[model samples]
Target: MALGWKLVVDAGDPHRQAAFWAEALGYQIEDNSTLIERLLAAGTVEQSLCVEFQGRLFWRDAAAVRHPDDPFDPVSGTGLGRRLLFNRVPEPKAGKNRLHVDVHADRGQRDATVARLRAHGATLVRHVKEPGGEWSVLTDPEGNEFCVS
Candidate 1:
């Protein structure tokens, strides 16, 4: 049996975080507006539970980014594979991340990639050089750490 899962990160501003990650990973921000509109029209969900962002309706506390090629539900726009869900949290990131994502780049592309990420609000934490290889640790806009190599 196979179990399916999506990576979830806590964020102070989920929509903003989703946008950042979407650009960083070349992913698409899931657009659930159609379903949200349907629910709103049918009175199934409260308007207060949703928000208007970039002229689209989104769940107030969460947003997601998905691999551009992944399968997704047409009605809900929910990705069926390789997704990252960002949910709002009351507090900011407090300490080091227990789990982090590593982004691999082609040989000699690490510096360019790191620079690009920096332009997208990722701050370089430090560079690690070891016998195995080299990678740069960076913190996203919300301070979650990831590595680029």
Candidate 2:
């Protein structure tokens, strides 16, 4: 049987991380209005724990971004497959990341992509030329690392 998966990331601010990664990957951030409403009505979550996301309600501490063509359930406003979930954490990042995303840019667009990401609060950590090719290592606004090639 075919299985589905999501890339889950831990961060201090999932909403911010989701926004940054959505823009970086050209993906759409998921809307969790149904979940939010249910939680609010059940008193499982406080209003302060929610945020207005893209003009809709979502959990303030977590967000999911997905490929545009991926399957999703509109009734729950949840992505059914192929998504990236960013969840909040209390501790600060202390060491290197065990996993990171790599972005592929067309030739001559690499530099421009790097600049654009920097404009969006990403920091350029360094550049590397590996046997495969050249790429830039960058960190998001909250310091999660990703590579652009």
Candidate 3:
């Protein structure tokens, strides 16, 4: 069987990164509020470790976005598949990402997709036209690279 996995990215503000990726990828931000509330009630987790964003409780150091169709734990609101977790870090991004995500546009909708992402604060780095294909590279709100093709 194949192992399950999720990509975790470092960010200065996890909530903002989660929101941006959710909007850009048409994903749903994992709530995790139920788990948080439960933990808070049980005194299992410190209240100082969480924050409220968009009327939802989130861990201050992390946030995540998941594919809409994936199965998730109802109580914890944690996605079981196709998840991208953003974690808070003290240092800012200083170099190119050694690993990046490639977003494939539907059919001939690359332009529209790229524009939508730009409206969400993704800045275009450059456009690449190689013998293999053409793609546009853009950095997320936190300077994480991703491509639209």
Write the residue-wise lDDT of candidate 2 on 20-123 in tens digits.
Answer: 98898888899888878998999998999898867889888889999889889887778887789999899988888999999898878999999989998899
Per-residue alpha-carbon lDDT of model 1 for 1-149, expressed as tens digits? 99999999999999999999998899999999999999999999999999988789999999999999989999999999999999999999998999999998789999999999999999999999999989999999999999999
Please give the RMSD of candidate 3 to the true structure. Answer: 0.8
Steric clash pairs (candidate 3): none
- Report the Cα lDDT for residue 70, model 2: 82
lDDT (CA) per prediction: 0.95, 0.89, 0.95
Residue 64 local lDDT, model 2? 90
TM-score quality measure for candidate 3: 0.97
Residue lDDT tens for model 3, 59-100: 999999999999999999999999999999999999889999
lDDT of 1: 0.95
Candidate order by decreasing TM-score:
3, 1, 2
Model 2: ten consecutive residues of lowest lDDT: 74-83
Please give the lDDT score for candidate 2: 0.89
Q: Give the true-structure RMSD of model 2.
A: 2.0
